[model samples]
Target: MTSPVPPADPHRLPVTFRPTRTRAVLIGIGVALVVVLTVMSLLLESFTTGDRVTFITTGLLGLGVLALLSRPKVVATEDGVTVTNLTTVRRLAWAQIVRVNLRSGDSWVHLDLSDGTSLPAMGIQTGIDRQRAIADARALRALVDAHGTVHSAD
Candidate 1:
């Protein structure tokens, strides 16, 4: 058995969203395939029908692999925040983000926008420092306070 390891100090903020239902389903199917593989091994099979199972397991595993590879990366600079998704990147001015807080479960950064809208910043992950995360959020709040106006993103 191995022990758990804590996350190292992250120099760059990379936000991740809650795994989508589609992704979770893929993982669940992969796990189920493991069970099926066990059953097939015990049965008297000739050519092995396990090929179908193997292909399914591989496909599901591929989904998980794609999810990880396709996750977005978020970077904060003095001027603005950048959200880099798989196909495109969008930059939001600091003024557009009224506040940024690690969500209750520390899953993602929740952005309270100037338009009374909230957005999940899927590019950053929640880390151990809850207090630090809150403090970081406050700093973002200050930035918006200085420059943000209603309908800024509009």
Candidate 2:
């Protein structure tokens, strides 16, 4: 059985939701990979200067990609929500969000907008930790309910 989600305090103007485990894993792996590659490049006596530089550069590029993968987060304030995905950052007013959904089998939470479009909220991902993702989704839903304005269809 699922427990009731506690009401979010309106006084808390800003709240951030992010995937902790995923971010930690990505960063840990990325850093370790970079360090290993760098050390190997330095130790390899057969590799020329150009080869060593290329190896280090490759490692840095891999780290950059991992960093991007771990960049998703959602910041909610009294005024609006700011969602940062892999490459895009979008700010949306409460009214702009018609609904927040995290259906079964969904990888992440999706926000239904008043414009009839859905925005993926990667910060509340279910892949790494399902329970935490569900909680975060519920919290986001509560925030939307409290702050979002209803738009009547014409």
Top candidate (TM-score): 2
Model 2: weakest 10-residue lDDT segment is: 1-10
- Model 1 stretches with alpha carbons more than 4 Å out: 1-57, 60-70, 84-90, 127-154
| Residue 127's lDDT in candidate 1 | 43
Clashing pairs in 1: 14-123, 14-124, 15-123, 15-124, 15-125
| Runs of candidate 2 exceeding 4 Å displacement | 1-11, 150-154
Strongest candidate by lDDT: 2
Q: Put down candidate 2 lDDT per residue, 1-154, tens digits, no spaces.
A: 4453454564576988898889999999999989999999999999999999999999899999999999999999988999999999999999999888888999998988989999999988997778888878877877787788743211
lDDT of 1 by residue, 1-154 (tens): 2233233222333322222443455466656766565565556465356665675566657656666634555556656677665556778877787666665675556677667887765554444334434444444444445545522221
lDDT value, residue 147 of candidate 1: 46
